[model samples]
Target: MNGNTERQFATNVYYDRTFDCDAAKILPGEFYYTGQDMLIVTVLGSCVAACIRDRVTGLGGMNHFMLPDGGDPASPVSASMRYGTFAMEVLINELLKAGARRENLEAKVFGGGAVLRGFTAMNVGERNAAFVMNYLKTEQIRVVAEDLNDIYPRKVYFFPRTGKVLVKKLMQTQNDTVAKRELDYASRLKVEPVAGEIDLF
Candidate 1:
C-alpha cells in the first residue's frame, strides 16, 4: 500500500445541517463548515492548502494560504492564516474545535496559479505551491488530490462534510486581471503629505 493511502480516511454522515454560504467573504485560513452540512466556496487566485478530515467523526477543515511563518514566536495566529505559518494551525484548531482528532485528518489541495502578466516564471503561485507541498510533506498529511500551477484562475467549491471539491477554470488569460490588480495596487500606494508653507501676504 502507498504511504498516503495507508493513512487516508473517509468520513460518513448520518444527518446534515444546512448552512447558507452566501456572498460573505472569508479571509485566508478561516475555515467555514457546518457539522454535517455541505459547503460551496470560491476563490480567484493562487493559493495552496492541506484539507484535513476525520473519517469517524465526519468533521474536516482546509488550510489555504501563501507564506509560511516557520513557528516564529512573534507570529500572529490571525496573520498566520494569510501566510503558511499559521494556516495549518488555524485549520487544525478549527477542526479540533469541531471535535476531530489529529490522527483522523486527511487532505486535498488546490489553487496556486500564475494567471497575471509580467511576473517572470517563478512568482507567488509557484512559491505558494512549493510551500504547500513542502508543508504537507513535513506534516505527513495524505493528499487525496491536487489541482495547481497553471496560467489560469480557478473557482473552487469545498464540501467540508464530504471532503469533495468542484473546480472551474476561468478563461481570462490576457492582461485584464493583471491590469485590474495593478490598478488596485496603485490605488493603495501611499504618497507623502506635502508640507504646508506659510502663505505670503
Candidate 2:
C-alpha cells in the first residue's frame, strides 16, 4: 500500500448518539469508505467533498480535499490537479476494490464555501467546486446532487450505504473553526509534496 493511501483513510471512528450509528470523521485531505452501514462526516470551508456510491450494492465512500493554489492552470497535469485526482481516485478505487461496479457509481457533492479570509479574491472555493464537478464528468460518474459556491461553511453528513447526504450550512459567525482548519490545511499543501499517483481501476 502506498503511504498516501494509508495516511488518507480517516481513522477517527466513533459512535454517534444523534444518529445512533457508527461514524467516521474525515478532515481535509482525508477520505472514508465502508461496506457496512455507517456515517462519514466532515466540515468544509473553501474545500469540497464528494460522496460516491454504488446504487445497486450500497458500497460507498466520501472524500474531502482542496486543490492547492499556484499550479499552472493551462496544464492538465499540474501539481494541483494531480493532488485533486489522487483524492478522488483513492476513494473510488477503494469502492471498486470492495466490489462496487464502475457502471453503478453515482455522486453527490457538497461544500466549496467562501469562509476563508483572503481566499475570496482568488475564488478558491469556486475553483474547488469546478474541479470536482469536472473531474467526475471526465471519469463518467453521474452527479445526482450538489450544493456548491456559497459564502457559508457547511457540515456534511454522508451515509454511504444508503447514498443519503445531509448538509447544514453554517452561519458566518459559526465558521471560525472551519476557517482555521482549512487555512491550516491549505498551508500544509503548499509545503508538503502531493500524494503519489493513484490509478483508477
Give the TM-scores of the predictions, in the order they appear: 0.64, 0.94
Query: Which sections of candidate 2 miss by over 4 Å?
Result: 1-7
Clashes of each: 2, 0
**lDDT score for candidate 1 against the true structure:** 0.53
Worst 10 residues of 1 by lDDT: 192-201
- Tens-digit per-residue lDDT, 2-71, candidate 2: 3363238899999999999999999998899998999999998889999999999899999999888887
Q: List, residue by residue over 71-141, the lDDT tens digit for candidate 1.
A: 33233333322345445555666677678876777777777777544543445566667667666676666
With candidate 1 superimposed using the best TM-score fit, by how many Å does residue 167's alpha carbon deviate from the native?
1.0
Report lDDT per candidate. 0.53, 0.87
Clashing pairs in 2: none
Q: What are the RMSD figures for all models against the true structure?
A: 14.4, 2.1
For this target, which candidate reaches the highest TM-score against the unseen true structure? Answer: 2
